[model samples]
Target: MNVLVLYATVEGQTRKIAEHVAARIEGQGHMVVLGDVRDPGFAVPGTFEAIVLCAPIHMGRYPEAFVRFVTDWKTAIEAVPNALVSISLAIHSDNAEERAEAEAYPIHLQHKSGYHPASVHHAAGALKFLEYDFFKRFLMRRIAGKEGGPVDTSRDYEFTDWAALDQFIDAFAGQIAQP
Candidate 1:
C-alpha cells in the first residue's frame, strides 16, 4: 500500500514522529510519502491508499492549522484506512484525569472535524525546554514539577515508547499486507 504520513508539529517533535512512522511503513515493503501539512503543495490526502496523521496537542488542543487541515481533508481521509497519532505530554501523566483528558482529545477532534480514523494511538510528546522561549520554559517547568515529570530545563525530555510504536507499526503493516 501507498501510505501518506502527514503531520503538523510544534517544536518539531511531531515531525520527527511522522518521519519515524514513514520509515516504519517503508521498511514493511510499502510505498510512503511523508509530508508536513503546513508545507506548500503537499500531496492531497485523497491520493494515498492509507494514511497516518500525527499532530501534537498544545495548550489543550491541536494547532489551529492542524484542525483546519483535518476539516479540509477528513472526507478523503475517511474513505481509506487511516490512523491518528495524537501526541501530548498528558498521555504519560500519573494522574488519571490527565490521562483521560489526553485520550478524550482525539475524540473531541473527531466530533468537531468529522474525521474518524480507523486507529488512534496516543503518543507521549516531549518537553522541549531547549526550544522554548523564556515564558514557555518557565510554564513547562511548573507543569512538569506538578506532574512529577523531569524539571531540569537545561535539557529536554522525551517519553515516547519506541518498542510500542514499533509494535503498532508492525501490526498495522500486517493488517495492510493481508488479503
Candidate 2:
C-alpha cells in the first residue's frame, strides 16, 4: 500500500509515534511518506492507498492548522482508506471525563473533517518535562498529581503502548489490503 503519515507535534512525542507507525507499515512492504501536517509539501498522488493523520493534543485540541489543511484537501483524503491517531496525556487517565477529553478531537474529525477514516486510534502521550518550559512543566506536574499520575518532573513519562500501536497498525494494514 502507498501510505502517507502526516502528523503535528509540540514536544516531539507525536513525531516519534508517527515514525513508529510508518516503520511498521513499511515493514509490511508498504511505501510510506511521512510528513508534517504543518507544512505538507507533497501533492497527494491519486494512486495512494491510504493516509494516516496523527497529532498531539495541546490545550485539549488538535492544531487548527492541521484541521485546516485536512479540510482543504478533504477530497484527496476521502479518496483513500484513512485513519486518525490522537495522542494525549488525557488518554492515560482512567477517569471517564479525562478519556472523553482525549476523544474530543477524533470525534470532531470524524463528524467535521468530512473524511470518514477507516479506523481511529487513541494513544496516550508522553510527558517530557525536559522539553517543557518552567511554567508548562509545573502545570503538567500539578495536573498529573490531580489525576494520580506521575508527578516527578525531573524525568519523562511515556504512556504509549508500542504493542497496542502495532496491533492497531496491523489491523489498518489489513483493511487497506482488502479488495
Instruction: Give the number of the best model, judged by lDDT.
Output: 1
For candidate 1, what is the TM-score? Answer: 0.96
Off-target runs (Cα >4 Å) in candidate 1 are none
lDDT of 1 at 80: 82
lDDT at 179 for candidate 1? 26
The whole-model lDDT of each prediction reads: 0.88, 0.84
Error of 2 at 113 (Å): 3.5
Pairs of colliding residues, candidate 2: none
Q: What lDDT tens digits, residue by residue, belong to model 1 across residues 1-179?
A: 88889899989999988889999889878998988888826566888788889999999998888888989999899888888999999999999999999999999898888888789888998999999999999999999999999999999999998778878877777777542
TM-scores of the candidates are: 0.96, 0.92
* Sliding window of 10 residues with minimal summed lDDT for model 1: 170-179
Q: How many residue pairs clash in each candidate?
A: 0, 0
